[model samples]
Target: MTALLAAWCLCCSLAFASSYPLIKSKPNDTGSNLLHEGHNNTGMADRCSDRGFNAITLDDKGVMYYFRDQYVWKGYIGPAELINDTWPEVPVPVDAAFRIHHRNKPEVHERMFLFKGNKAWAYYENKLEPGYPKLITDVFPGVPGDLDSALECPAGECKSDSVLFFKGKSVYTYDLSDPSAVKERQWPLVQNCTAAVRWLGKHYCFQDTMFTRFNPVTGEVHPGYPLDTRDYFISCPGRGHGHETRRNATLMSIKNRCSNRSFEAFTSDDSGKTYGFRGGWYFRMDSKRDGWHAWSIGSTWKGLKGTVDAAFNWENKMYFIQGSQVTIFLSDQIYSMVQGYPKPLQDELGMQQVDAAFTCPHSSDLYIIKGNTLSLVDLKNTPRVPGQESSIIHSNVDSAMCNSQGVHIFTGASFHRYKDPNELLQAKELPEARNIAAEFLDCTQ
Candidate 1:
């Protein structure tokens, strides 16, 4: 099995290299065309220096579109255009948004509504559409008048039968199982419904109350086991089960109350019913002057059924640069955990700060970013037995995306793809990847 796996990995590496056709490099000045007429400022030039002026996305049909924020300076909706591959200048509205949030499946048609004061606005397709961001009475029949508190709400379909919406203190559920589509509200059930995941036909919610599982259709909380609530706010949940589920679903909770208190990170098998506490870790500022920091944690988070094995840590503090290297907190320290044991398996990485991280459909491969650079890690490489070091995939670029089939990294404006074991082995050759795989090191430097 070991030899076969090694051979399979080798072929995958070659295939990864061959997936993209090499193109000639153009002068870095190509991005300047998209700049505003009077923006001759060097600061603006610096922003487009290393960064490509436009972002690209491949649709289900494999058609690539280039997007740019025309209103980036005005603090308004940035319009994106479907620039032709041949004519990159002709812009069209592919989508528009005041801000964009990245996720594994950030469909253009899907909308995220944020409550601002008494009103709400829907952020979708890269623009804020004119409409009530809250659940309308038309969508949820017989909503209470008192519930008209203009709260920010984001709704998603957990499964065919389960639809969930995150409000302030409550997460409401709508059951599509019935022909009539009855809406059932479960408020104040999970203290903070910041992040949620659906597994085994059940929905898990994480917030101030730790984690809890609910029947997607009935909105009933699970009976046995509740999540560890030692901390008031559990940030991420379901770390190792990303592809199998959604969101890392990894839960981070405050363990104590020191100004810089240690925290615990864990994953749940019984939906959110029970969580296996990994260990304690802390977040620290990366540099005193930069005010950037990194998060470091122990290998306490695990996978469902405790079958997949992996370990995780942040590689660097989040930072961004425009004209000059400006230190900005792009993301919190990252935490990773994997599936399998003894040998490398699969893994998932979660951003401690930003809402962007890559999750494979059902595979253990995970990726996260700091600024523009991307890093890959595998949970399968770690031993299931205690006290073992796991392997991680690393790259020099910014940002990465992955599915069950393979992983892709975004360097400059282009993307590079890699297959598993081979990708893992190739990653092992690089210095950054090797450093990340070494014993847990603090990135707060």
Candidate 2:
């Protein structure tokens, strides 16, 4: 059986958000920072924090459009501006919008479709196409009017280039290549998609102030999602109530310098839920959790305490390596720490502390990483023991994961995708496929 999970949740600027309003943890108190903290304070007031958007779309030139009641925020870093001031031909308060940027299709000419009421308008590079304001059905057959949100799922992600039209809890997938292959389904996590946009190569579904990153092909959302849209999408200096945007972080929300994506101990268990550890909090990779985001590690994991150096799952059990010690937990129906499991790492795995570790899909070999070197542990054998350590592809590995897709090794804010375990084991420096900030989390552009 194969597992699917985000390689690692980028240690985001908001991973341990003090802006969350009245929640505290012990992690930042020890004077340790999982990542650096930025100190730049934007003097401007107002937070892109809790406001909702009516429509969201990205242009070919990388400009992001965020609409909310006749106003729009045009880029990642900016204040709200009048919609008419920018796109003169486009109407205000567009219910839904999606871009068509296919190279093969010239008739549409890299245009954008904006929906309002029952009518739809096509804009080529923001210029309204002639004979527009047509019925929604006429523009996008099989799609309903008054959509909650819409975004393009281009080829390679979805089977074919397609558009997702959202309404309440229902999603209508309109295939661009084949009009007859329309599909409709219910996604409970996305109760209301006020806005959604496809940036880089990932898809995001938004509601209120939160957004969830999801796969366009399978509609599988990353676990521990539904994070704040403002933290990742909009740059609001003094966002955490006087705290400014920075490349580092502090304990208190008042001192937060949000926007450095770094994380520790990223792992996925037998149940398929992925967990990302940062400071005193952890983000679970599921969006179905009641409009929630991060959780205190102690509040959920139970009994496993202190700093987590590395983490991985084997035989339906979770292993969290912290400094010289390791904590084991039973990951069955109920998450519980195994008795007498806060043992020394050397006693159990014949090792001290490690940088990162992960078990690949359909294999019994567990890769335990340290620095740029790694040791192998055969899980199918009687006793688990680390073999000779040798050099590997990445250095300062923060986390690792394995799904049917491939083995992902995360370092800093970007990660390398190895087609399989063997491909990763033989590498010196593989090509990085995605950035944790841009692709994994909907945090940066």
Candidate 3:
């Protein structure tokens, strides 16, 4: 009876201990009023769900704005912002958008058009045009309402400097010079283009998370039609080998991928890019994404070679540990290794055989994990002795991280999260490990 009562009390304490919601999971976002009760603030809605973007357009300066529902991503990779913040006059749920760019017609060229339902909005440099919020029928005379997507078709690559309006499987080609003479045709290449854009003298159409490059004049979709958006457009971490199934491709279970499996090293850098390493490959986890994509260490880290044992970002520098060696790289526009790096772990920090290394917010100390022991080493002293050494909850931890919110001890594909290091040491007994992939990394069943 006493044991049962103790177990219930422990469970209650654990439930109450989880006060901090995991980072990048939602809320405290933008610090804007938009981070309200029900509104999603984790940039790219639903934690990197690619249901599809409704509209995409490039500004006069060639800056891309990808819109999905009420949020807009300024660049390819984004912690998205509310549409009203950028375009206060423009309404939400934009169906289609396109910017005009013509050297000959400079007066009207920079103007952009956004379509939704029966309404058409025109803006020049983000300011609503004098006469806008016009009906779609009035804007193009014959263009249908509730457009799927739209893009500007320049004359050099097209028959005319026209605008392509997509709806369902059909397209309406409206020539800017001759708006009355609208041509409509069934587009067999792609159906219901979710968003379309004219980028750097080329035209591309998107359907869902898939896209196709095509010629507007010849109506020819390039041979490699319907490519995954993450491949070229955005910087999506935890990405797989193309969403489309290929005949020659070998499918691997989630167990094989570090994203859903054991991690050799894990760190959330000062730049806010969360990375997990396994073997020779590393996965960059986006703040707003519940996905994983792996890249080779040799290819990404340049000079860094082989699998890493531990990684941690301190100040503006990133440290990668391998066996008894440690390599430090500067976190900047380019991650360049510092001079005289790849130093002996013992010689550099007086630590040996580190299983994992991590640091929490506002702390100048690095926590080194070895077996079940943790050694707190100050960054101020090199070849330093341990300041506060203690035994932690888990033994033989595959990897670990102290991501501001809490400390996670990763083992195999699962992770046991504790509120903090002090609490874990106090508890003695480890908590039930949760599937890291299932909760945030989104493993394939």
Best by TM-score: 2
- For model 1, residues 123-165, the per-residue Cα lDDT tens digits are 4433445544444444344332222121111123233433354
> How much lDDT does each candidate structure score?
0.28, 0.64, 0.66
Model 3 misses residue 308 by how many Å?
1.4
Checking candidate 3 for backbone clashes, the offending pairs are 43-80, 238-292, 238-293, 239-292, 239-293
Worst 10 residues of 3 by lDDT: 1-10
What are the per-residue Cα lDDT tens digits for candidate 2 across 147-265?
89998876766777888889988998888887777799887666588988775345788888888877666667766787877565555544432233223344432222123346776
lDDT of 3: 0.66
- The C-alpha TM-scores of every prediction are 0.28, 0.50, 0.48
Supply every candidate's count of residue pairs whose N, Cα or C atoms clash at under 3 angstroms: 45, 16, 5
Q: lDDT: which candidate is best?
A: 3
